[model samples]
Target: MAGLPSAITVYEVGPRDGLQNEAEPVPTAVKAELVRRLLAAGLPVVEATSFVHPRWVPQLADAGELLDTLAGDLGDAARDLPVLVPNERGLDRALERGCRHVAVFGSATETFAQRNLNRSWDQQFAMFAPVVERALAAGADVRAYVSMCFGDPWEGDVDPDRVVETGQRLLAMGATQLSLGDTIGVGTAGQVGDLVRRFVAAGTPVDRLALHFHDTYGQALANVLAGLLAGVTTYDASAGGLGGCPYAESATGNLATEDLLWFCRGLGIDTGVDLDAVVAASAWLADARGRPSPSAVVRALTG
Candidate 1:
């Protein structure tokens, strides 16, 4: 606790990132309710959905409809909703729906870039440039997610320098913030510390960076602690630990929002989130999905 920030921001990704990979289609109304519950639970930033084509991620096909519902229902709370836009077309859809905050995803490795975006690293940046430019010009906040920042399933042990370079490019492309992702869940605490330090040294502002980790290797919280020590304040988490990269075979569920809240609570760090409420939401989501909640905290507390 000596060097960590007194408070941190948790960006909830359960409705979008969490449910996008589910094999079964979650009803559009269910997704709307999930976002509502997460907001009611005091999550400051909730990623609502993605504008990716339904042909690819059919689960989130109702992205525009969901946004419309939230706009009419959530009112001011809807201002915090951020959706993922994969390219110019996705950005166009989001803008047409009056989205104020959006995120574009890229990769640090060539394999994931080609697999997920159908482009190489340079090409991916080229693809994102216009999206970022158009979003910023439209007065929307743009967040960039750089995947495989720590390790890639195909290319193990990604270089920190490369990660920094990718993050810088994103920031330069009008991205208001960068979320560095450990896509394969192979990152360690030490690796996190080194990477954050390198980013800070290379002139990247700590406040503009976020960490997105998967709990596959059971190292999510440890790496989070490391990020905290390195002065990172924003983190991305999914309720009930519900998401994994569909393109990466070995990747697993994201760091559970309830689990992260529990850890932050124990550290006396303020996340402005209710742990019990998040657990209840996760439990509800699990029941709806016809599966057990993957969050350790949710399971233990509910049981």
Candidate 2:
């Protein structure tokens, strides 16, 4: 606690990242309810849904419908919910529904760019430039995501330089914040610290960066500790540890919000999220999904 920030931003990705990998369709109503519950639970930022093509991610096919539902119920607050948009088309759909906060997903490795985005590493930026330009032109706050920052299944041991270079381009393109993702959950605490420092040394502000880590190798929380020591103040987490990459088979669930909250509480850092409320919400979602949550904290609290 001596070196760590007194508070950090918990960017909840439950409704979007968490539910995007579900085998079954989560009702639009259910997704909307999850967003409301997370916001009510004091998560500062809850990503509502993705505007990616339904053909690709059928789980989030109801992106527009879900936003509309939340718009009707949450009013202006719905407009502030962040959504992931992969391209101009996705951004159009989101803008049509009044989404003022949007995120663009990118890759730090060429293999993942080609496989997941259907573009080469260089070509992916071309695809994202207009999307970021348009989003910023429309007065939307844009967050850029550079995935596979630590390791990639196809291309092993991604260099931290590649991640920093990718993030530099995104920031230069007007993205206010960049989130470096351990897409395969293979990053260790040392890797986390070095990467954040790399970005900083490259002239990127630590405050303008966030870490999105998967728990596949059970190292997500440890990496978070490294991040805190390195001066990052924003973290991306999913409720109940409910997401994995549909494109990357090796990828697993994200850092669970409950797990993160428990860790931060133990460190005496403020996340402003209610642990009891989050556990209850995740428990309710696990019941809806007809399975137990994968989060250790959720299991310990609910079991």
Candidate 3:
């Protein structure tokens, strides 16, 4: 707590990354309610949805409709919600719907690039170039999610240098921020600290980088502490630990917002998020999903 930043940004991914892995598509109205609830709970940046083709991610097929529903209530504020766009078509759809904050998903390993993006490691950049450029042209902010940054399911341990290179390129391409993801949640605290320092040594600002860790190995919070020690100020979390990689079979739920909030509160770091409100939201969503939340904090608080 002494060395960490006094405040940090918690980017809420529950609506998009959290719901995308559901077995069935969530109703559009429900998804809109979730976004409103998260916003009301003081999550500064709640990602609304993804524009990927329904054939690939049918769970989020109602991307457009979801945005429309939010717009009706939130008006101009809806445009500030970040959404994932996989390509030019997806970007077009998001922009047309007045989404001002967009993100592109990239992979740190070649096997994942091939499987997830259907492009080789190098090829994926070309696919992302137009999307980033066009989004910037349309007066939008672009965030690049570099997944499998720590370890990959197929490729095994990923090189930290390679992750830094990918992140630097994304920033060079006009992406304002990079969220390095430990897709399988196999990274240790030492590895997380080293990676953040490595990126900083390579001239990537710590403020422009974010840490997105999964809880599979039960190291998500520890890894976040390491990132904080290395000066990262942004983190990605989902309400109720509600996300996983649809492409990688070994991946698990993301760091729960409630868990992160409890951690930050203990350290006296201001996240501007209401822990009780988020717990309530997650509890509501758990019923909608017809299951108990995987988050420890949510369970203990609501149990």
Candidate 1 clashes between residue pairs 3 or more apart in a chain or in different chains: none
Off by over 4 Å in 3: none
Clashes of each: 0, 0, 0
Clashing pairs in 2: none
Whichever of 1 and 3 has more TM-score, that candidate is 3
Q: Compare the candidates by lDDT and give the number of the best one.
A: 3
Worst 10 residues of 2 by lDDT: 27-36
- Report the lDDT tens digits of candidate 3 across residue range 1-303: 479899999999999999989888899999999999999999999999999999999999999999999999999999999999999999999999888999999999999999999999999999999999999999999999999999998888999999999999999999999999999999999999999999989999888999999999999999999999989999999999998988997989999999999999999999999999999999999998899999999999999
TM of each candidate vs. truth: 0.98, 0.99, 0.99
RMSD (CA, Å), each prediction: 0.9, 0.7, 0.6
Error of 1 at 299 (Å): 0.4
Candidate 2 matches the true fold with a TM-score of: 0.99
For model 1, the stretches where C-alpha displacement exceeds 4 angstroms are none
Per residue, candidate 1 scores C-alpha lDDT tens digits across 156-196 of: 88988989999999999889999999988999999999998
